[model samples]
Target: MAHRSFLPSARAANVIIALGAFALGWAIYVRYALLEQSSVGLACRTLETLTCETRATVIALFSQSAFGIAALIGAILQLIRPSLIMFTLALMATCAGLVVYNNNLAGLAGGLLLISFARPWRGARG
Candidate 1:
């Protein structure tokens, strides 16, 4: 009798991918929503500073959006075909997003999925 490793199935992977998509969507939505509601607060506080408020806002927005987009793409690819490349990309994107936006929950979820999916287990072997 061979021992079986606890690995997620394709269905589980799909679920994880869906969750990642949701996270990506929420991140984008929330960031934009906040900006729209309180553009001044999100901008730089000092007017005399070298860095302009508008410039800071644009940079932050771009960084967050780019990270979310990359993660979303990676998640979509993983859903279509589970691969190490896709998993790594997704993990990296999620980490970057967390660093930029301080989104702990999304980062943890995405990281867990990527780590679990990357490993070779009984059910994941396809």
Candidate 2:
């Protein structure tokens, strides 16, 4: 039988790239436009508007390192059983976490994801 490589196909790579880029861009927008913007921050701290409420919610989640935690969990799962879904989840969460002040666990998750790439192909027979 012909050997099947574990590497992602071009289409899969494109999808991953697109999703990762979107996650990164969204995180940057939230960090700069919503969280760091003085007007937005002030409004969120004081006002009860819908935008401010949304900002507060995002702040609470990132403050608790939810994104990093999720990335780490996805990375660990991917390391244990390498799958495209888990890999994509970890990649997207890692990108978002790194940009949204969850760098510590997200960095660790990134390393774990890298290590997982070295794992033997799941379909390979010994």
TM-score, one value per model: 0.39, 0.87
lDDT of 2 at 93: 99
RMSD of candidates 1 onward, in order:
9.7, 2.9
Candidate 1: where is the Cα deviation over 4 Å? 1-64, 102-126
CA displacement after TM-score superposition, residue 47 of candidate 2 (Å): 4.4
Could you give candidate 2's per-residue lDDT for residues 1-126 as a string of tens digits? 553434566788799999999999999988898888898877666678887877888889998999999999999998888777788999999999999999999999999999887775565443
Task: Write one digit per residue (lDDT tens) for candidate 1, span 1-126.
Answer: 353443445675576467657756655654564434455444545453443544466457655676656666676566455555566567557754664464554355465554544444433343
Question: For model 2, where is the 10-residue window of minimal lDDT?
Answer: 1-10
Most accurate candidate by TM-score: 2
Give the clashing pairs for model 1.
none
Superposed by TM-score, candidate 2 places the C-alpha of residue 106 at a distance from the truth, in angstroms, of: 0.1
